[model samples]
Target: MIGSSHAVGTDAGKSVENTFTLDYQVSGVSQGTITNDSAYTGGAGDPSPVIDPAGPTNFTVDRMIDLAVTADNSGLVVPSNAQDRILQYTITNLGNDHQAYSFSIADVAGDDFDATGLEITYSRAATDLNGDGDTLDACEAEIVDAPLTATVPGTAAGSASYTCDIPADLPFTVELSGDIPDTLADSNIDNLVLVAETRNPNAWAVEAVAPSVGGVTANDADGTNTITGLAENVFADGTGTSEEADKDGRMSAQSSFVVTSPDLVAEKRVWVLRTESDGTACAGEAVPAVEPTTEYPTPGACVLYTIEVTNTAENAGSDAENIDVSDILPENVAFVSATTSGFNIPGTLTFKKADNTTNCDGTAGETCTVALTGAGLAAEVGTTDATAQLYIRAIVR
Candidate 1:
């Protein structure tokens, strides 16, 4: 059977405060009841999840791979007087991400660039390094302005390339070019630097060789003679400096000097002053002779005469006298090479009286004889001349 239960509660109301009371109890044991609380509150707080923007991607450049130059890379051997040469450069991208690079050259010491005629050129190409199916138009090229620019279609990860050409003058500076972009990370993108040397083939040369000097004759008038030659080297080494063309091409320190004795004559002797080079003497093909006139007399004519002989000779003399004639010989004639006509022997001779008489004295009926005889006669005759003339000679041992 079902049983019922009941209970009661009270609520109070007062003058100062009002209150209500009510109570109720379950009539039978039954299932628990469910209640709904609608007016409940909680604390305030931040939201659960948030979204963040992506960061900038950094580009990495591997080595400036497969760098190359199209010029005579073996090295430019230019003449010192030649103009500049043209050079080309090629650089490939061996990096993973797309990258940019720049190029520049150095104006080295003893070199010049940026002249009016100097110039350069550039180009680019993009190709896959591996045999991949990806086709990327990552090739860009431009003239090397102050800021060089080149774009590769695909990322620089595989096969990106660049090329440049440079022309120079005056052996001054070498041209450099490459694909390096101006970016926030790197402001200067110079990829390569090189130098070309110059040479001078004709820098040194011989300018002149002196002409030969003529021979001189020895005479009593002039004592010393001189022979000379002049040579010079006027070429330069393109640098305004003198350089030696050959090791032994210089002029010798000493000049040349010479003296020669003259040829034989009737009562006169001759001497010569020959020219020389490097101490070697040179004789004239023909001996020079003095022309005789009334002023210069012959030997043994009893005429007024003067003798002139070069100082180089010690034994120079002449004889100008008539044998058989009583006339004293001219003073100009000294005993050089002499001979007698009336004497028994032919030799050097002196004039004397037959009987030691002074003033051309001799026997009363003997013609006042004066003649040469004996060894003294031969010695005197060898130095005496019949023609009233002077003789001269020079000897150098």
Candidate 2:
């Protein structure tokens, strides 16, 4: 029965109007989850992006490691006669970075440290990492190879120290070895350096000494002879000092020694004693008298007298002695003997006898025979040339 009530509703339905509203919440939307499925699915999108942990922070080195040597600050001091000396050294690491380092020493290759005269040993602590006193092989290593090695604790480094025995008489050289990663990174580090020092001593020296001579005696007619030892009769001329021998030491003196044997009578025979440093035979001077002393010549007639003279050159170890005789033949008297002693003779005169008949054997006192030749002999005779010397032997009788 849609009768009367329905009639009112039909009219309302015919006049009714309809209205609609739409709203959307996007907050719930997110990048689609990425599932670990073997095959790709069309509905979901790619997963969320990811950021990698920052790469290792730029590598940093707070400070570089350094190596240095410490020993006798200025240098080593050695005694004059010292044969060997000990030298010590401390190696330090001045750096902030932990380092692996090493050290070594060797003669500069072809060069020599003169170990022959030196006694060398390494400190036990320097060689052993555990500090159990032991020699390190690195201590003996040379420049051509690696020397010391150690892994320095982080931010701190250890020391590799050693000692060397050097010769006081000679020179020495030192070198180091090991990896210096920072300074020389690519290949094995080969840095070559040389060190050295010297030692020497003082010296002493001596010089030659001279001697002096005394007067002599003579006989009037027959020949008289006397002998004397050079050492006892002679004295050193200058400072009679002695010294030790050294590098540039020296000594010098005059080798000339003198002798004076005189002529007493006009026909008097005289002979001279002479010897060499080696005690060898020598030549003699001869003279002849114009007037016989028996004639009783006038006072200032330049009385003729015969005299003999002898000279001996000393050997390396010997000295010369001067012998003199006087009283018989006064000054300015003419000498007729084969030799004249105790007087100065000029080179221009014929004083040396042709046969040297007046020459005396140093060992024997002999009479001299003489004959006058050339212009009659002139008196005053002496050696024009004088030689300074040292004598090893002498005879006084």
Candidate 3:
């Protein structure tokens, strides 16, 4: 009549047995010992008298559904106004049996902004085909179906066959993809949570689905009268920090998105674009790199100035927009023509009067201006560097 809870390390469906023995003494004198089953030969008394069954007491262990989730990247760097930004997580089946899981991403309260179009995806085959260090490509990790099934780890080497796809006790990688809102300044943060619920591997149903919802009730129809001979399911999922309840067959992990902004830095230098012998400026000889620092430019000489604007910001959400670069001409110099190079977007180069109110033709007492609209300067993203150069050719008065 002794019982104990199942041990944790015991294999699912394994047998657990217990037997009892009774020792009697007559008038303070030791008699003989009788066992509960006939299989015990060492007992001196008639084994049939106490034999409860032909064999020892035994019952198969029931399956325990448990899981754990961890965000692969603690801080996911996301660009604002970007679509399908990926947040990766790993879900491990901690229980003794194979299980499928349904995933969801929820916005955490007290955060900066919420993500839009939240979707979950994973890839058992062809993960990260584009070699971009992530499975965000269209052809990679194509499985978007809910309740992603897991295979029991098998002895096979490849996933081409049925048994090879078995992932017993192995972890599955899942992606939570969403779109970031626009106009989010740098360092703004959005806390997000990814939840995973356990499901019946073969039935494609939630393991903890309530009976009122037309799902199987826990411990089967017999309830507490569980027949020790048969296997049953016992929900053992842990409560998570992100509002997950214990033994409810669900778990969750948290991740975040910090909005990043573009940091633009502009550097400008001037040189006298002229052949030293004469006052006439030459294109090949007097480039912007060869600035006239030691010797000042002669009168009527062209003072070539080059302004280089570089988007130094890394992981910027969007490109620098509505950009305007201007330089006021000194009274001792006359405004000349302006041009641009190394610019991905088209811009207008104009000269303005000293008052900065009206546009003026390249003439004396004017200011040089460059106006860029509609996708101005590109942000420094990934391997590409963003730099735009403006060339101004003004004459010494």
Candidate 4:
């Protein structure tokens, strides 16, 4: 109850960076020939013609699963002590087959802005109506919806703090394993869709029909979305845009929130000059100074006021600017003169602005007695001045 011909099939799980080999043999009674001329006593003719072709041949499987990531902050200014600072990131799957990733984005220290109360969540981009591009074309805004499955736990229900694997004690200088971008390219369909637009498989391209045929959702992020679950699909020959996952062609997405704010401190006192015999307490310091108090000087004494303004170290690659400060002098004092430290305004006060150069005006009794105006009052880090400290001294009569 059997046949002469037979077929065998084998299932090799997922695609990987490896090759395989297969070998087999078949034997049966010989039906070809029996050459016995009988010139000799003859031999024991066992007519089982056995044939086994060259084997151990190599076989290559191209079922691949790769991931990639991209981080975008949209250049949003997140002030210090700010809340709900949302950062949008897109994770793309560049592999021809479906994939899964343990997504992550950790807050690194040393930027002067601690990633305090750092949290993470995910969302799929909205549909693009332009029909030219993916998410961005439609709703590039932070339209965060529930992930295929939530990995940040309670975050899906409400804004919740993220669980960081990196310990707080870790030194800032140490580049830990849990860095900003730690995975492969994924669901940002634009990469492949654009490439598939031309439909020319790159020099490394090695498939038939592209997985990009899925278009925007070509790589539907499945599972918890804390990871990727890619849908495996082969690309077309010479037109394939499929990438190799194990060969640094994986995918990923990452983004971070930044907090920035300016801190301004003002100190008012009368600069009382002290000679050698003035007092032992003032002898040690050369500069004229006054004791800090609610009301230090009589109406006749010259009142020296200092305004010190600075800002928290803004996020890296960020600029702190457009900061202005104003003060109201005491009713007993009259504005006399004001000057800035060389640390900030080393050169003469130009009062230069956009296509105009002007001077500040206001007497001591005026409500705007001493106020920093124009662009001169900026906490510039990588700008015209190297010093972040802007010193302003105003003496009132």
Better of 1 and 4 by TM-score: 4
Clash number by candidate, in order: 53, 57, 7, 50
Over 1-397, each residue of candidate 4 has an lDDT whose tens digit, in order, gives 0111112111112222322322233474334222222222222663332232332223333333333343444333334433334455444433332222233233333333333333445444343322355645223233334232222212221122211111111111100011121111222111111011111111112223333321222221332222212222232212212322223323332233332243222334345332112122332333334354443344344444555443322333333344455555554444444555523333333322122333323243433234555433334442122233233232334
Model 4 off-target regions past 4 Å? 1-61, 74-76, 100-102, 109-113, 125-144, 147-258, 262-397
Over 4 Å off, model 3: 1-8, 18-52, 124-168, 203-227, 262-397
Cα lDDT of model 1 by residue, 253-328, tens digit: 1101111221111223333323211111211122235442332223222121123211111123322223222223
Rank by lDDT (best first): 3, 4, 2, 1
Give the poorly placed runs of model 2, Cα more than 4 Å off: 1-52, 60-65, 95-120, 124-397
Clashing pairs in 3: 151-167, 152-166, 152-167, 152-168, 153-166, 153-167, 153-168
Q: Pick the candidate with the highest lDDT.
A: 3
Q: Each model's TM-score?
A: 0.18, 0.18, 0.47, 0.25
What is candidate 2's lDDT per residue for 274-318, written digit by digit as tens?
211112211221122332333233322222233333222111211
